[model samples]
Target: MNRLYHVALSPFCRKVRLTLAEKKIEVELVEERYWDPSPDFLRRNPAGKVPVLRMDSRLMAESQAICEYLDETLPNPALIPADPEARYEVRRLCFWFDDKFNAEVTRPIMNERVWKKIRKEGYPDSRAVKSGLAAVKFHLDYMGWLLDQRRWLAGDVMTLADFAAAAHLSCLDYISDVDWNRSANVRDWYAKIKSRPAFRSLLADQLPGLPPSPQYALLDF
Candidate 1:
C-alpha cells in the first residue's frame, strides 16, 4: 500500500492528498512532526517536508511533482489538461496559489494563528495576522475574476489548479480565517470542491487540541 507522511493542516500535504483521492488511490496516512524532523523522516525527504509520499517502493517529495506524476501515470481523470496551452494555464495557476498565495497569505496567517499555538511558541502577531487577512481580499477577487470567465479555475474542466487553490483555502477555512462572504464566486466554487467525495477525508481531519471551525465540515455552508 502507498503511504503518505503529512501534517493534518498543511496545504501542501492536503494538495497531494487531494490528488491521490481524486484518482481513487488508497494511501495510509502518517502524521509527521515536520518541525521536529526525525532522522528517519530526513532520510525519506532531505528537505524535511510534511508531504513525503511512499508509493510503489519509491519516495517522492514536492507536492507539484508528485501530483503531476500521478496525473501522467493514472490518466483516467486527468487533472492537467492535454493541450500545451491549457496545461500551461493550469500549471501557472497552481504556482500562483502554491507560491504567491502561500507566501502572501498562508504562511503569515498560519504562522501566527495555527503554528504558534501548536508549537506553544507565543502569542500571535497582530500585525502579521492583519497583513495576511488584508492580503486575502485581493486573492479572493482574483479568484472571483477567474471564476467569472471559466467554469473552473483553469478552464471548463477541473484541474490541479483548482485543487491547489482549494488546498490553501480549505486550510484557512479550518481556522475560520477565510471570509467566504468576500466572493460569491469563490464561495460557490469552494462549495463545489468541498462537496466532492475526495474532500471527505479533509473534512473529517481532527487537529487534536485545535479543532476545526464549525463550518469546516458543513457541506451546505
Candidate 2:
C-alpha cells in the first residue's frame, strides 16, 4: 500500500492529503517527527520534509510535485486546469498560499500557538501570534476579493489552488485563529470546500494536548 510520512497540522502535508483524497487515492498516514528525523526518514527525503509519499515504488518529496503528479496520473477529477494560462494562475495561487501566506501567517501563528506546544519547545509567543492574526485578516480580504469576482481562487472550477488555500486556513481554524466572519465571501467559500468528502480526515484530526476548536469539525460552521 502507498504510505505518507507527515505531521498532522502541517499545511504542506494537508495540501497533499487533500489532493490524494480528492483523487480517491488511499494512503497509509504515518505521523513523522521531522524535527527528529531518523536515517530512514532522511533517506526517503534528503530535504527531511514532513510530506514524503512512498507510492508506486517511488519516494516523492515535494508537496506540489507529488500533488500535481497525482493529478496528471489520475485525470478523472483534474485539479490543475488544462489551459496554460489557467494552469499558471493555479500554480501562482498555490504558491501564494504555500509561500506568502505560510510565511506571513500560517508559520508564525502555528509555530507559536501549535508547534511550540506540540514540540514542547517553549511557551507561545504572543507577539508573533498577534502579528499572524493581523496578517490573516489581510489574506481573508484578498481571498474575499478573489471570490467576489470568480467562483474559485484560480477560476470557475475548483482546483489545487483552493486546496492550497484551504490547507492553511483549515490549520488556523483548527486552533480558532481564523475569523470566518471577517469576509463573507471567504467564509462561504470555505464552507463549501470544508464540506467536501476529502476534508473529513482533516476535520477529524486531533492534536493530543491541543484539541481542535469547537467549530473545527462542524460542517455548518
Q: TM-scores of all models?
A: 0.99, 0.99
lDDT of each: 0.95, 0.94
Candidate 2 per-residue lDDT, tens place, 42-112, comes to: 99999989899999889999999998899999987999989999999999999999999999999999999
RMSD of each candidate? 0.6, 0.7
Candidate 1's error at 184, in angstroms?
1.0
lDDT string for model 1 (1-221, tens) is: 99999999999999999999999999999999999889999999998787999999999999999999999999879999899999999999999999999999999999999999999999999999999999999999999999999999999999999999999999999999998998999999999999999999999998889999999999988
Q: Alpha carbon lDDT of residue 35, candidate 2?
A: 87
What value of lDDT does candidate 2 attain over all alpha carbons? 0.94
Relative to the unseen true structure, what is the C-alpha lDDT of residue 6 in candidate 2, on a scale of 0 to 100? Answer: 94
Off by over 4 Å in 2: none
